[model samples]
Target: MYENKISARQLRRMIFIETFGAGALSIPAFACYKEQNGFWSLIFYGVFLAGTIAFFIIFSGKISEENFENRKIGKTGLARNVNINVSKMQTRLKSINFPEVLPQPIKFVYMIRFFINAVALFYFFGKTIQTVYMPESSFLFIIFPAAILLCYSLYTTLQKRARFLEIIFPWIITTYFIAVILSFIGIEKAMQIGNAGELWQGILSDNIFRSMGNGYLMLLCSSPIEFLLFLRPAAEERGTETKNRKVEDKNNKEGKNNREGKDDKAIRDIITAVAGAILCNVLFCFLSVRTLGPTLTSQSEWPVIKMMQLIRMPGGFLERFDILPIIFWILCMMAVLSGYLYYGWSIFQTRSGGCLKNFLGITFVCLVLLTCVVEKHTLLWTFYLKYKAFVDFPLSLILPLVVWLFKRQKDFNYQEKT
Candidate 1:
């Protein structure tokens, strides 16, 4: 067992299954739940959950099987030989510590990641406490210190980490799935008496944008791409050791046309990343729609517990549990903060060229926290005006400019060589 380890393709499939498990179920289902009837909503969400799990299994299996068959000459060697090599590789990989190629300044990105992770996560924790415990716990006072502690613990644990995700990722996703199922049930019950209209009215009448806290939710799209980009500068260095080697663009046969095609593919990938960001914006819009009722109530300091009091589930040892609201809020916060940290690290790793990295991460985190804190304190009319000028405008406008500038630089370098 120790000698014969899975290949990189298998690892990637595992990562996808691990990363996307609970998240896939919750996002689309929760977004559209209010738009459909309770019985139908339950069925719709059920299908969504089933579809996601199926996709994971089928996709992962296909990739793993493909890797198994497309074995390099070395892969098809004697089983004993392959096992010995596998054991050696596994031992070597285990002995590795921090990514050696990463520069020291980039480590600061880890710090910023932790900081943003703390703020987004703890802020929501405050709201959760609002639901279960007291709302007046000066959540920051509680959460800030907690963030520091968690970060320190995280640093130590990560240094010693080995196959942590292989175990934890599946569990996190499963927990997330359970939480979403519960939220769906809650949403279904809430909609039974035609309460959707009331929530919609509150959203329209109240400040839903501020409640959702800027377009930070939309940053979810960029989060994945940001990591991909971080992976990019390193990709040109990785050779074919990682997965998807078979899909690599041919460089040896390069002619003018092939070179242009490669450039075009790079351009296309960047555009795809940008397009993903836009799709996330749309998804966040849906999430904003779902959240209208909850945010408005939270802003008014209305007991979130009371709002959820009508929601109940039955049929299990945990059926009497009414903690779905807290779960949704916490998971949402966890996803957002974890995303911020992941992207913040990517940006940090890439931006070691200047203080620009620090500026971007700090600005992003500050805006996210401010949007949430102020929403709870003020009305929608005033907050929307502020949010539009500050948050939404920068992401929509400034982010494009950054991409455009990078593309232009690449074009100029190509022209100079020609």
Candidate 2:
């Protein structure tokens, strides 16, 4: 019943906010631990992340969003929802004559991927808030508001979400850059350009896995773009039913023009994702060591807050600039939390379609809360790193390649048939 579309610029803003925010604070330490030179860590993160995003952009463009639109999409903004009836088929399903009742693996895998990304992020945000920001508050108290905001975001149209991000993107940049600039006061002038760290070949051999873990944090920070948002049928899509309309437009449009139009969009999509990832990440890592020396940067737990705290604005304007880091954390965490909730709820709908969606949604939220409350946050962090090392790397790389290749094969077969 709802219809929404956003410009490519709006989509780019959303990606920027998500990819750059939360990781900017704590991840430098993780990267520093892995690389002896410290510089290679920054370079590795950029190349590793840029490649993953580039693959996603090219693949998302290759498959038209309209293909998803041509079918009935769930409320979650994704394409696939396997609605299986197991009642009558309970007996037949046991007999292996249950193809119809079988769960779809692709949908299941994507669903799992989105949930893992979301939950890991959700836990991180909650932990940050619980520890540094609000030590007195209970875990549930810190997480509750975020959960509500996330639910609200999921209910709104994607265009609205993008629009909200556009408004905040500037302040996010201003606050972050100001902190980076002020950070110069804390470290030596000459060391601002280069960090003090020993160089070694351990980067390629020993510290590679930890780098993968940190790189995964960066990659999943903003989360991958949801292709169905574009591919699904827009309200204007059905207008093509008018034959006279198609003929009139066909007469006016040349093949070259159509190809150029698509190329323009494809280029914008790639350039935006790549540039945003690199720029945000590079500035973040550079500022980390430039603002705080390598030893301190690696030692500090909440580097963003620590880095921002050291910068005292001239004229004694405010007692402390530490609040800037908090603002940054809140902004980024809200966006990330909402994205996770949306993906999680969407997967629930895909699995159980009806009132069960409501039940499962509530259950999912509660389970996440319970896990965060009972589980030690440090242990959870370790599990997240291990998951990234084992699952996320292959999943992020292989999924897009498989999808892109599959699309190519389908196109080749269609051309042969025609």
In candidate 1, what are the lDDT values of residues 177-227, reduced to their tens digit? Answer: 464455456556454233777745544553333323322322222233222
The 10-residue segment with the lowest total lDDT in model 2 = 90-99
What is the clash count for each candidate, in the order shown?
A: 0, 6
Which segments of candidate 1 are over 4 A away from where they belong?
Answer: 1-125, 149-169, 179-239, 242-320, 328-332, 345-390, 393-401, 414-418
Q: Report the C-alpha lDDT of model 2 over 311-351, residue by residue, as the tens digit.
A: 65567776667777678767976776666555455545556
How many residue-pair clashes does candidate 1 contain? 0
The best candidate in terms of TM-score: 2
